[model samples]
Target: MKKMTRYRILMLFSLMIVGITAHSEPYEGVKDIALRRFPWLAKALVFNVIPGIDGNEVFELSSVKGKVMVSASTASAAAEGLNWYLKYYCNRSMSHFGDNLNALAKLPEVGKKVRVVSPYSHRYALNYCTISYSMSFYTWKDWERELDWMALNGVNLMLAPVGMEGVWQNTLRKLGYNDQEIAGFIAGPAFGAWWLMGNLEGWGGPVSQSVIDQQVLLQQKIIKRMKQIGIEPVMHGFYGMIPSSLKNKQSIKVIDQGIWAGGFKRPDFLLPEDPYFDKVADIYYSEMKKLYGEDLHFFGGDPFHEGGSSEGADLAASGKHIQKVMQQNYPGATWVLQGWQQNPANGLLAGLNKDKTLVIELFGENTNNWEKRHGYEGTPFVWSNVSNFGEKNGIYGKLQRFADEVYRAKNSPYGSFLKGVGIIPEGIYNNPVAFDVMLELGWHVDHLDLKKWIGNYTKYRYGKSNVNVDKAWALFLETAYSSPEVNQEGPSESIFCARPAIDIKTVSSWGTRKRNYDVAKFEEAVRIFVTASKDFEGSETYQTDMIDFVRQVQANKADQVYASMIDAIKSKNAGNFKSSSAKFRQMILQQDSLLSTSKYFSVNRWLQQAINFAGTKSDKANALWNAKTQVLFWGPDNNPKTDLHDYAHKEWAGMLSSIYLRRWDAFIDREFAQITSGNVSEPDYFKMENEWVKTGELYTLKPLKKRERDGLVKRILANNQ
Candidate 1:
């Protein structure tokens, strides 16, 4: 009998407790998730688990006595079967946009058995992440709907970093840090993911212990739900990332990760070469096991993530030791790495054990890194589509390219490394078609014809089809959303969401405002899409899309106004300048009004969720500050040195009329005053922007019926033309 250490003793105790309660059935929560989202489907359909090949989890459907039947080997594959019945037979469908289901109607008679076997073992979701920006404050209620959305779309592996700050809090305190010191280390709800990965640190601090404790409990619930639904929740792994303050005290060799996004202190990387690294990694896992339990299999963390300093480091040794630490505690675990922006470097991949590692080819839409890097140097990888960056609202996706690329890689020489496919939007709400089409590739055996697929998609999307809607989508395929003939990142940034400038370089710091598609042709498609609005007026999905499309049209029209303003300034004509400025201001107000009609476009909903996330008044204020800053002026707070302003800018209703409009109004006033007086005047935008950041502004958060935006969409379309 071997003597057990204290941590080892706790692990055994936990195992004994967990053994009694653990259920081994894989597809446990398939029905519960379905009932939560679509209760009516329970009466119409049935799901069961059956044994099959590992990657080839199968879902088969049959009909008897007017009852639809389903048999699936996994929860997600079962949901896919439910999805198939919803789309092909019943013509009722589910999408990221919304659902189109008619409970009163009967399922179409299934004469032939409809069976779909997923070819890939992994179909994943999220980035590292704008889910923080878009939905950090999301409660279990919000998550219930989202998890249902994930299951319906067949997302099996998801980045569920909901409450990692709590883990960090407990982990650090046990490592000899005071509560105040620990508070300074953990970021707020908005910046939790980035801080966890060692990119930037302590920008959104000092988080309270109560919040941290609350989050630990919340994460337990999130993981439980994820496991139940057959989705493997990827939690933040401890890869020797400690606070920068850990230097010069302990004998441990801590490599300073330095600054990221200008002047924000990056967490010091704990050198695996140092023997003290094992101590930190040990306690971290011990604490993690206590809070989250031990059934977890996937761990996500990157050391030199997006410009972390790599001095005093051995790359190969670091990778090996990090993965070793993770495997030692959590047996037979897979290390999930981000294949983004020169990450999982040749040396890094060389160190990782091939069988136990999986790399997310994150920028698959833009870069051919997997092929160039020899499928992450022949290590197993997922060919993922990260279409949306920062979750900016844009009607853009490389739809045909996604189907083409995923299929092309599947049959390529290095095809064995291509283990799966995924939808990795930094934020997920925008581009329903982009996500819908990508996830479907998991079940596909060959190349998909997006042109033909759109016909079926439109029918299922709106619960029925219309000739005009079909024609509009035909034009859509060739224009607005057509895969760029050249390389493009995400969607065009809307000028309405941009900081006020006549010749704005880019909407976000690194993003472009240039429309890659032919604007005029896309406008024509929008006009045609609106023609069939009455038929799809009942569709929440269609109406939601219409409002989004109309907003895009109006945003595109603002380009002409911007051009007119620039021309007036160059020509030194005050009359033209005043005229263009007024038109620009009016457009902002109209855009706000149009957006207010839709629930999804409400800024109030976002900010209010942030406020509600906190307990006390001070925490609520802090939460609101963090919320507003992320979407409007991404911050290090009032500092002129920060270049992150407008990085995550949203073009939502309340945001437009409130912050953006106010900023533009001030810019136009100062510029108009100067240009008219025969003097060139440049407004001090940074000064004005800094002042706005400190102001306590709030937006209304109320839901409205889609009908409110009915006439408004037409008016926007009519005026833009």
Candidate 2:
């Protein structure tokens, strides 16, 4: 009996030690990513967790017995360390355009043990607009790929407001609201980002119940994946954005938030001080918990996004009450606020607990909101950049500015409150380099000189670097990716995608047609980049970039043609106008053909993805319409001259030939008539745009053969020079 008891005690003691050792292993999530993405290298890689110095996340890389060993404080850090080795040593990388994550013949040796400590605690990603612009049609497969990328890049916090449609539906229904009423409150999939931001109530939808249910399932999967990888999702939280019609049915003290941009009616705000506030907030969070889960820690909702009335309400007390309700439901939850164009008002800031609130400085590249607002009045803030807007196609990013601003913010007077860095691009699809550099900054304490940094970037990005490729990037940094101390919305707008106008000031509203960099330098870079085609013929990353650079040159040429046409119109040179306009039309056709060579630049991919996401034929049609309308004329339907038209413009293959070129044809013909004769005709573009969306044409990819694509690229580059 004594021997048996001693044996049991020893067994229990051994089991406890085993558990401790297992728990101390490097995060399994990071290991999972390695197995899934780089199976060839995974078997040779060992991961182990190490204590971080002074509560900061850190990663170490070393080689042990012919194996790559990664040690880190967290899963995100482990993933970053793995990526660091892949890029610096293996000369391989991944991006949205294409990944060069091919099987390695042998693992790269780490000659010296390398260690990196992250200064920032919170590395964030996504903008409200990013959900719609970049990922509206994403499926579980798409999201899985995205989450893997996010984890690898060390994104610990991400905005995930997808399943809120069901949450609101349940909350409103339980509060005695009918189905029809609930339908009116939920926006369509493409418009959910704006809807969540309290900009509009229902524009893209009267969404079907099944689709809403699908969103719930999708969000559950998303958050699950995010949590597994150590990323905390910023789920949509209740911030008094109720339907305006709720006032008629209930006794809540409602503040009407009149109209949003593009003529959509804004949702009403329930006064947080009202007795109904607690009850409605309770139902909202309860429904949220029932739909999502109980482990959520971060909540995102902005009241008065862009512009909305706060009339007859105590702003300070209202902020306090709103935050209190969130804490009551999810204890120790953080209220994530956007610092953009006078938001998180001083009155609002005065009432919140500084430790529990995080402000995202949305426009870090152009505006120093973090610095200007004195670190959001000394509240914890993350510096973020919105490099791309509306997913517009053009090569742009102030690469050095991103690194400079982040380092500056970290060392500034409010450095103590500067929590971390983030990539808040309204659209994430366009610039891979921008996102890559910005995210990597979180791992560094000092700023990186982009001139030196992009050399290693080119080596990894294209699998190997050539001298011509290196020279092209040097000019790329001087031109497209140059850091000019001027405020710009996004990449330079392509005049090819612009609405036809003799005096074109901008393409979409708030977007400039100005190629801020020297166009000749950019064209020269394109010419040099094309020279490496033979060397990198099998490289998808090189090919995609080549297509983009050539496309930008075509866009720049269109600008010249446009200038000539306008000059002819002004001087009554009808012959010159006719020739220039004809050239412009031909250029659009060629541009369409060039864009067709990649799925990334195909409008068919967008429409087909949307249609594929739906079940019923009617749902597919609705989804297709939503897809078309969003890219062409993001609308309120009644407003013809809506500023929102073409705001999400793509210089895509199908879009150019089918919609933009068609609209331009009508306008050009009208101009020709007015110039040749005394006839003044106007193209009703709004009607044309609406008709195009209803056409129900599902465009398909027509990728050109490599020989044909290369020839076309060569011809375009030669002609431009």
Candidate 3:
């Protein structure tokens, strides 16, 4: 009787343990991401989490009874395994522009168990500027897709400084600062990146409390989703940046960081030695923990970022004190620093605990700072590429250079501290191929042959490999995507996006107008790419690429017209000038029509996104203003001649029609009149631009029908040829 009673109790306990294990699904988040993105495939997929192989994330792919099985050591690895199967076996993929994740009739059989293991300790994504340039007005829906893509691409660490406004607001409130003073500290939605970097303060703001609260909620959701997918959120760290007004409030040693570019005053640097510094930092971290959980492990901030003054301070002590406060709040946290243009100074390095720090080489495409600085003075660092600036529309990436550099870094003498690889584009909206190749390098142990890789990329990117498509990609490899040993910021600047000038060398201040690749060769590739359009009419990815390629050819032709018009101006040929100027204006209008065929290149879509994110009427107005200003004048309201104007220029459809078109018209009409009848009047371009921003007009247009779009492409190609 006693033995039977003991057996019954043991059985009950065993059953209870089974119930708990069944409820806890470790791979559930990744499964949900797969389902939400590729609903058809998700239902036929099986996921299982197993132990890691030698402390590195691993995934095994196979097919069992017609269902795709992905067994991984972690959720992120499972998502990557699912991506690999989709790309290689299924011939489907996702990108920033569009997705090719259509339903398959049947699951493709993985005949053998295929396994992949990432060699890097960390895989990171995003830039501080990406917060404004690519994702300033992102809603939860946008974030959902962003995080989903991150998981599939194996991004385990991402910079996410989204809701710092609320943190600052609460921290200031606790420190006896008024609402008005706090308002002066926070920047607007479109300009938060600069604010967070300590380059400027209150330039685009005096934001409503409602928007602040909304961002706080949005950040909460973002962090929650990221944690589930196994991606660490690198929140903004407090690095002694205080308002310039803080001097009037308290007696403390403050270094005046006088001014930044575009005449904006930089925030004052608080001496880390001051007692007030510790007090303020404690409150700041406490509020941050209250808002975002204490489970955070990484923080990103740079002292003296982007030419800010770090005058009259002990560099070594300041660095140590900053990291000390951070460690005090969150034990074992890593302080992530940007290695760009003489940053993470040697003195600062001398003070840091190397084990608790990670540096990101921000300009790997153009600079070999890692080698130059000896792997950031032996501190753990990630090799990174900042391929695009301001998210400019250009077909540019040194595909071979990317592969060569990553391979070189991994095998270099300083390889011991080379922690991982990452993509830190100022804008992540363009050049999807560049990012895909960079991220996938983490999984590769051997150096890649980019030529063969391009063929495979073409296959998965468009859902099939055609002879014409393959030929075009080869031409692409030699032309725009070619790795020439030259220093260029992004793809060649579009002449159409340039602010109207007779001798314009670049569209933005630091951008270039020179095409380093062969324009004719690029055109030939576009020609061949168009030939496969008939086979891929139903593929969204193909259609989008077709529009983009054809658009590049149009931009090339605009450069020719611009040169002819300038030559006419210099030679005093009024008739030639008139014809060339008219042609340029007509091309701008035509380009707008061409871009209208895709929402990806539509300015109306961007504005709509900004408007849709706002809850109140006032918020809507502010959001719209923020959106328009950012892509155009990007201003300090008072500085009309600010060199920062058109720094974040876009070549979108409605933007050309509404903003650039008008600017060109004003300039051209005046120039033509001056040439023909000696009437000279300079247009107040800054005033004209600001007026356009306040119009509240959305230049919405229906996308052209397929037949119309095809005809437009053909017309453009023929005219350019």
Candidate 4:
């Protein structure tokens, strides 16, 4: 154990005091998030508030015949408190929305009062990166369910920037921009994350007025619901990100933020010293208050996000000025900055009042930017882990590393700067084990024995324990999810998500397309997982996860087949190339068929959400195009060989058969034709890719029957043998 300094010990005690004092009374304010998320439990469960529990997020549970008593500080916390009690004490748990619990057939009997207190003041969730890939097109229905999940999992703070476009539009309009100009300022639904980060401007637009207005209403619902459940909503702040044409439209001094990937125009930054800076600030904040209200205490924004030009500007002054406007509008507001590469730069942060700033270490799962920079020069930060990107389907996370890093950061010399820990994945659908452990760490102030914890997690994740399942998880921890190799950002890009390539290097721009784990071990884990399918067939979480693990094993084998084809091509072996290519196609088709068994893995469902949000024929076309463009070929249009093709690709049933498999088949057939003719005709990949992206065609998805899916999964696992 590391010896703590006097300053550190004192700070820890002070934080404990503050945290304990904050929870004086029980909070029974769980609202729509409860009703929408845990509809079964919400109705039957009777909750109460308990003051002075002596610990953070502490809840007392006692149950009668048909009624359950849950006492906590807030109803939102109470919901999680009740959930924790259910999972640990009663042998019942809810892992995800629509996830069934066999125990849900009957309520639990907590014979005596049971209490569990939270260990941390903050338990945060999500990253700005999550907004675009996993949730950009989300309506209130999606938000409602997600919020409920957050409450159940004990998320007290969340980055909830649902309707930022409306705020941007109304602010710009007050600054003399017309309707057409306002439309240009707002990016489409798919690009909200980067747009809010000031990375790009109007690239995926012309957004309709109706959409913007609808978002305003949507945000109101999100914020209100968040407040009811003891969760504090963090809104996006105005930090000098004006439209690309705002300079030409106004006399303000705006900096050209340069261009991003695929030649997209980055948003221009309004200089803090510009005479109209205060005027726009006043209007933007006023407009935000009018729509989203003034109760928000956290604001998130960063200028020059990712790659952008800020060569001449005084960033220190800019940071101070941005915080000035935020603090003025929402007094004592915590300015949330994405703690990413050299961002919230030393000189920049030097100017801001650090007391009101919260920096999220965006990639803490891989990079230790917090310790490397000495905890953002003493400003408060949250240790966060971003284990996924673009919501691309792949099983990956540093589960043990998540526990290790959070524990170390909490005890390091600069630990005082570590306000708390959070889970900030670019997407949240994959790797439920990673999230479970990360959230559990928030309540564990002591070091975690992962060997012991994994057992509890396996028990609760499936609602019952089976030795085969536990062994599979143990193998999983040793293989796919726990490999200790540093690859480029996010999960290793799946070949199933890649556009057809002889030598695939990346699926998304800058994403590393390489496997770093033992393929055989992962397959063995999947095989072990499959044996329990019959035992846990009724469990949704178990079935969904079994499909995912099987899909990963098949995809990895499919990649090997792809490599063999590429190898054959390199050696000019036409016969071998044909054989290997055929196998690659077969592997993808098999994986697709296997994925169709899970309801959550449907391409039709993913696409329909985009379609459902459309208001007009043009709106529908553009909306659908936005959906396809983002996931397939995120682009700037002129360049046929855009490096950003297949950036956010999914390995769902329809996408595999229709898009990726089609592309691979085209590539293979072209090569075979050229080889036979000896014509020296080179295949035009860009043409086929562009043609595919331009077509707003939705493919047919055949969802399999339970027994049919089970049989297919069994057959798929046999290939691994």
Colliding residue pairs in candidate 3? none
* RMSD, every candidate, angstroms: 5.9, 1.9, 2.0, 7.6
lDDT of each: 0.80, 0.89, 0.89, 0.78
Per-residue lDDT tens digits for candidate 4, residues 1-721, read 2456877898999999889867642344563444554556666676676773554567778887777777777665686776676577555555542364454677667877777666566788888778887787788888887887787788888998888888888888777799887777688888888888877778778988788888889889988888877788888888888887777767888888887877777888889989778888888899899998889899888888887777778989988998998888889999988888878788888989999998888788778889989999999998888888777788888888888988898889988788777889887777787787888787777888998898887777788889999999898888877848484577777787776666878777778767777778889888888888889867888888888888887777777787898888778789998888888888888888887766567776667778887678887777777787777777766776666767777888877877777778778887777667666555665676567667777765677787787777777778542
Clashes of each: 0, 0, 0, 4
| Per-residue lDDT of candidate 3, residues 560-662 (tens digit) | 9999999987787889999898999888988899999988898888888889978899888888898889888886878987878888888899988877888
- Which portions of model 1 show Cα errors greater than 4 Å? 1-28, 53-55, 678-684, 687-696, 701-711, 719-721
Model 4: worst 10 consecutive residues (lDDT sum) = 25-34
**TM-scores, one per candidate:** 0.93, 0.97, 0.97, 0.92
212-268 per-residue lDDT for model 2 (tens digits): 989899999999888888899999999999988889898889888888878888999
> Cα lDDT of model 3 overall?
0.89
lDDT of 1 by residue, 1-721 (tens): 3555877898989998778546453354877765665677666665556776665878888997877777888887887777777787767776656678766455577788877778888998888775686678887777777887788778899888777776777777787888888877788778886787787777677777667777777788888888777789988788878888877557778878877884677889999978889988988888889889899999989889998877768888899999999999998889899998899888888888989999999988888788998988989999887777777888888888889899999999889899899987888878888888999988898789898889999988887879988998888888767877666667888888877876886888778888888888888888899988878767888888887888888998998898898898778788999989898889898788887877678777777788778898778877877777677666676565467777777888888887788778877887777776756566665676655555666666443455555666666777542
Evaluated at residue 188, the lDDT of candidate 1 is 78
After superposing candidate 2 on the true structure, give the runs of residues whose Cα lies further than 4 Å from its correct spot: 1-14, 17-26, 719-721
TM-score leaderboard ranking: 2, 3, 1, 4
TM-score attained by model 2: 0.97
